[model samples]
Target: MALNAAVALGSMFFGLVALFRPQAMPGRPLTSPGSQMTQPSEATTYFARMYAARAVPFGIATAAVCILLPSQAAIWLLAAGAIELLDAMVVASRNPREAAPPLLAVVVHIGSAVWLMTA
Candidate 1:
């Protein structure tokens, strides 16, 4: 439960950063620091902001479920895990070299989901 809360808060923080300070996001090794998208086009910026917006709500919902509706936490955690796993796959497909972090995140989400289910 505590772990879930922490993860949720962390997600919210990153989501906020991604939303307001997309410039702070890490980029690929070949790209400039804090610039994930190869070319900083309007469409890319829009996508970044949109992703951030989605993450913010997801984080809030996850935290709310963990705190206010404990019984639903397991299902939510599992869903989050599945989402992260798919995200990892997408990241890997786009950039194999930079997939480690997302893969790690998928592991953490899945592990947390398992823990929640067992607890």
Candidate 2:
């Protein structure tokens, strides 16, 4: 439960940052780092904002499930784990070097879910 709450809080923080300051967020650039496009395009910014918007709801839902439905928290944790795993995969596909953070998130989320399930 505590781990879920922490992940939720972290997600909310990152979501807020992505929504408000897309450029500052890592992995927002649509183009490869070696690409000549030094600046992020409007479409990239819009996509980042959309991604950030999604994070907000996901974070809120996870937090709510942890607080209001303790018995169902494990399921929510597993869902979050799956999402993180996907995120890691996407990042890895794009740039293996930049995949560390999402990969870490994947491990933590899935590990927590497994722990919660066994608890």
Candidate 3:
């Protein structure tokens, strides 16, 4: 229960960062201090913003359900896990090395789901 809310909040935070600073997103290299970061192409920025938009709403809804309807949170948890799994697959298709974080996210989501089910 708590895990779901925590993860939801974390997702929202990440989404917000990605929305405002897409270059700071995971797998997207960030320039070191003092070095100007190269801006991504229009298509890249567009897609990153799109992803951020999806994440924000999903996290908000998931967190809302977790707090307002705990009994229904498990389904959202599972859905989040599935989303991460698919994200991992997509990253793996492009670059296997970049898939680890999302794969770990998948594990966390599944673990949270299991904890919710057991508790």
Ranking by lDDT: 3, 2, 1
| lDDT against the true structure, each candidate | 0.66, 0.74, 0.75
Error of 2 at 18 (Å): 1.4
Best by TM-score: 2
Q: Compared to the true structure, candidate 2 yields what TM-score? A: 0.76
Query: Stretches of candidate 1 above 4 Å error?
Result: 28-39, 93-101
- Give the local distance difference test score of model 1: 0.66
As a whole number from 0 to 100, the lDDT of residue 92 in candidate 3 is 86
In the range 1-115, model 2's lDDT, one tens digit per residue, is 6667777767777778878776666654665456566556677678778878778899888888877887767777878878777766766776777777666666766777787
Residue pairs that clash (backbone atoms under 3 angstroms), model 3: none
True-structure RMSD, every candidate: 4.5, 3.6, 4.2
Per-residue lDDT for 1-119 in model 3, tens only?
66666776777777788778777666654454564676655555676688788888998887788789887677788898898788789768767898886687778778877877898
Error of 3 at 42 (Å): 0.6
Q: What TM-score does each of the candidates earn?
A: 0.69, 0.76, 0.74
Q: How many backbone clashes does candidate 2 have?
A: 0
